[model samples]
Target: MATKKKPSSDQGSSSSALDSSRWEVSCFWERRLQKELMSLMKEPPPGVTVDAEGAGQNLTQWIIQMDGAQGTLYEGEQFQLQFKFSPKYPFDSPEVTFIGPNIPVHPHVYSNGHICLSILTEDWSPALSVQSVCLSIVSMLSSCKEKKRPPDNSFYVKTCNKNPKKTKWWYHDDSV
Candidate 1:
């Protein structure tokens, strides 16, 4: 006796099911970010340490930490970084911000804990990874010749109505 095989209903469904087997149900970007995180953990940036924990009530969001490198005002200090991964992912960078009470009060960072980095904005490229962002922050801190916060940090953070997204950053000066 010969057995009959079940016929697939739709091409899209069949293709999607096959794809789902390889990819996860979670947002594609989150998976990509997680993979990047794992790679970074294997070889983390210099002077900075990081970890990711599931956010309360939201598994998609991760809580990260950035320990101040040894030679900056942020040195020896511990800061919490929040990373909210959107469905767009590698095409769109994560929404990251420095949180926690001990957050740095730097020229480029706001009191509310937002960071002003070019790579996080217009300079962002799909070629960039989470590790690169952390490394950039590390380099930014190391290059700070003045240990004081930007004279306008408070003003900019408080008064600037422009969204971090709307304001394109110009990273011309490495001097912080």
Candidate 2:
């Protein structure tokens, strides 16, 4: 996790649980994010691509595009993903959401673009990368036989925090 400090005379400030204070993404983490970005650009997995220019200029935010995997329920469909990193990235999971025009309609996905994927929250680990997150999303969509929204879509979408990471998510089923 990122080190936290009260408002200070410093070079960087980041949003955290406490709105009154800010956190800093240390140089070590910046270099690590950069390295991961490079590796992803060089050899990304199938149906996944990142906006390198965006990622380079702003390490804390990224826009990713993922095409639905072949032979899957969502084949040929395109979806856009947005990832917002806090100072605690890799330690605190990124605020990931399906953005843009075509959000997939899987049971775990709300119309508001929030996805109910465990890895994006409770199951996240420092070992997971942006590439791995995309893969998991694709796998989630690929495994679905029905194209529908979550059962609580209406209520949740209306009440959830703009950042999906802020939600107290309850993951009941992995078999979806």
Per-prediction backbone clash count: 1, 0
Candidate number achieving the greatest lDDT relative to the actual structure: 2
Candidate 2 per-residue lDDT, tens place, 43-147, comes to 998998999999888998999999999998899999999998876777888889999999899999999889999998999999998988888888899999988
Candidate closest to the true structure, highest TM-score: 2
lDDT of 2 at 15: 24
Tens-digit lDDT string for candidate 1 (1-176): 12232334432223345355434223455345555655665677765455543442353566667777786766787777776666677777767678788767666777777778877877778888777877887777666655566556766677665446555555666554
Give the clashing residue pairs of candidate 2, or none.
none
Q: State residue 115's C-alpha deviation in candidate 1, in Å.
A: 1.6
Query: Candidate 1, TM-score vs. the true structure?
Result: 0.72
Q: Lowest-lDDT window of 10 residues in candidate 2? A: 13-22
State the weakest 10-residue window (summed lDDT) of model 1.
Answer: 5-14
lDDT of each: 0.64, 0.82
